[model samples]
Target: MNATVVYELAGSYFGGTSSRPVPAKLVVADDRLRVIAGDDLLAGPLPLAEIVVSSRLGNTPRMLRFADGASFETAGNATVDRLLAGQGRRHGLVHRLESSLRYVLVGLLVTIAFVWGGVRYGIPALAEATAFALPEAASRQIGEGVLELLDDDLLFPSELTAEEQARLRQRFVPMIAASGLPIRLEFRKAARELGANAFALPSGTVVFTDQLVKLAEHDEELLGVLAHEIGHIDRRHGLRQVLQSSALGLLTMTVTGDVSSVSSLIAAIPAILTQLGYSRDFEYEADDFAAELMANHRIDAAQLGTMLMRLEDALRKCPEVERCADPERGWTTYLSTHPPTTERLQRLTKR
Candidate 1:
């Protein structure tokens, strides 16, 4: 059984201004909307084609717009529902998004989750995959560029007696070379402004600071540090770190037909290393590599753990505030990226 839906008319005063409820009844049928006021037929048997319908999901009134920009409203929505049901076209992806509180909230939550996941997981995985696929020459270029930055601001020629440097290199080189990895061992004197820190470049260059060499109580301890840095190069961790830092910009360029120079990626490495520390897993993996290298060479792996502890103390005493945690001296660990020394020590000494 079909019932006629009659909506009250709030007709405009003086034909087109403010509205006042008139004594009128609006009758809606399958094809048209009709209205009668004081025995006068007001406006149409108007076709649904020239009418636009909009409504909320609940009890709120629906508004209709006529071709001439005049409008009408109905309370209780039942009449609007019937009229919309017969209209050949519908609108309210816009209407539902704006008017339905539940759907709007759900959409907002889903969008946030998607963006968070992309940043946390998707971007890193893509950056790693892309980084690993790059040519070895490109990586070396990146390493050289980073070394250039370090040389410019943080490092100078090593002051170690050549005889001492040659002796250590001769022993360390043969041991590391046996692993079938190509690595260049270079020594430098870190400016007093920096502390004892050793990092591998993507080009397979493992730079040793004279301070780090002097900090090592045993040659084995220095070898342990060298092995750890070799692990970084062997796994291409340096290049990956560089790639990950500038991923969004690099990815944007790749997609937009503006692939630029690898030099730009290299230039950013100094900031990335100083400010953003490597991921914890990379640190652990490098630690594992050093341990394995020590075991293979008949050297005690505990030497690495002992050296890590001392390195922590050395960094603590450093004058650079960005690399240490000294509240009285304005140094904070905010820029420190290395995994906690206690954790690395425990892992290295486990066996």
Candidate 2:
């Protein structure tokens, strides 16, 4: 026969059917546990395994829950710990972790690293994969109302003559054909609103502002810009950018528990598409694609660099007060959404 070890502690007992708690004493012997109120037996000598012990937190009362929906609440935390230890049971894992400074610092560092890595690499990779996997019809649908919205707010009908538009189209035909993407070229005049800009939509639509057309000194400059826009379309950079922003927004919502903010994010999609710039990686990828395409067509990629320089010089001449007042105009311009002109020019020159 094994020798029996016993322990006791005072607590409050709640029977399965009662709302009131009665003063009681808990008794434990070997593998069994029970509760006693004076001479009255509130609970029987049941297996200790059937009782669930709540972990310690601060000086909060601990709860020992019984199988029959009864419970004993006690503030004898140290005694409980000793009792659990005597029984060869593990307890207070959370409290143990919380009490350790090294563990807390390590945990915080791991969380920071996780969030940083997700934003830096994981999110962009996931967005790119999802963008590529999305159907063409879906991309087209996403872009359908965008131009109309831009026309309402920012753009105007092209003022170029019909013959001029025809000539540019004819000049761009060979490069467009070589791209193997369904391309739709649209013309708009931003006047002084958005100076020297071109942008590509997710739906294979590329918009060329009259400011950009007039700014170009050579046909090759225009073609270079065309190939760059086609690169955005071919690689689905616009859709990827939107996906990346949405993923980041969702991550923020999760961290902050602000579900209502999601509608505001959705409402801002048009602004994001028009005003926000693509990431550096996406810009470099598009530039490289443009460089290769221009090279294959025997066109000097340096013409694109030349046009970029002119656009920068033109924008620099804009009064700072006006530029600051209409920030979106600056954001949506060609140079605004691209990398530094000098670096891009260097890369293009090398090609």
Candidate 3:
């Protein structure tokens, strides 16, 4: 009779049943062992002291013949002597087995949590990598389409002329190329009402609102912003974000495939676009890239720094003008995705 006794575990045999190989940590608990096995308790705390030499099952079943010639099958779940062999509470079957099992389960849960978090942040990176591999022409087309989609009449002026567009391209294209991004530049004829914004699309296109163009005192200031956006492009940050959003859309559409799903995805477009900010590392890389471009072109890195300060100041005074300005906030999901302005300025100054 095998029973798990909570008190003193002395001389008992305890072990689990195995089809092929026997388990190592098998032992018993207490003098008169009371075990809980499955739903039903087993054969006895009966005075089994006469039971001499209890043996556990191995691959081969051997009936032990005692000094008295009495033999019993070791083929059962656990022998009583084995269960009783456990010495103390810490070493007992319940303590050893249950505690080890609990720890194993906990370890599994922690691993799962780590994996989930990595996937959540990693999907965008995966998407970006894929986007970077795309041809420059395809990327530009995507940027153009996004600009058309986002720039409402209130945000973008009516139209830009071919000559003006060429001028903007001339200013931006070489810089983008030098930054190792296969990106094309598109300019809005009239400044966007949205004030001083430039962004990239999945297809290798970057757009600067006319207002953004007018706001820059020097080409380097524009390059600073453009470089940041290019950083987003080179790292495939924007493409990854767009892909992640689209993947979410696909999941929603799979679940509900209705007009509501379409509307929901459309409604989420702004958040999706705005949410695709670069990480601190990416931001720094872009800043350095811009700085190098400026240095090579003999442009002042401090001017880029100045532009940032100006943008920061503008956001503070005209908070209502910018939708995504979190004044003096720290460690935001958004901010975490972007490099800090202070570091960029410091690095530039040091250079």
Best model per TM-score:
2
Model 2 over residues 1-351: C-alpha lDDT tens digits? 978877788989998999699999999987788899999899979988778899988789999998899999999998888887877888668888877899899989999889777777787788889988988887788888999988997899999999999999999999999999899999998856776899999889999999899989899999999999999889998888888888866776666564467776675454344334446667788889999999999998888888888787777777665553332255544435556677788888887
Ranking by lDDT: 2, 1, 3
lDDT of all predictions: 0.72, 0.83, 0.56
Output the lDDT of residue 226, model 2. 94
How big is the positional error of residue 22 in model 3, measured in Å on the Cα after superposition? Answer: 36
Model 1 agreement with the true structure over 72-157: per-residue lDDT tens digits: 66663655665566664554676668667898899889976885566466766776788778888878888767787888889998
**Model 1 Cα shift for residue 170 (angstroms):** 0.8
**Two-way lDDT contest, 2 vs 3, winner:** 2
**Between candidates 1 and 3, which one is better according to TM-score?**
1
Candidate 1 residue 232 Cα shift, in angstroms, is 1.0
What 10-residue stretch in candidate 3 is worst by lDDT? 18-27
User: lDDT at 79 for candidate 1?
Assistant: 52
Tell how far residue 232 is off in model 3, in angstroms.
Answer: 3.2
Question: What's the TM for model 2?
Answer: 0.76
Stretches of model 1 off by over 4 angstroms after superposition:
1-88, 92-98, 248-278, 319-335
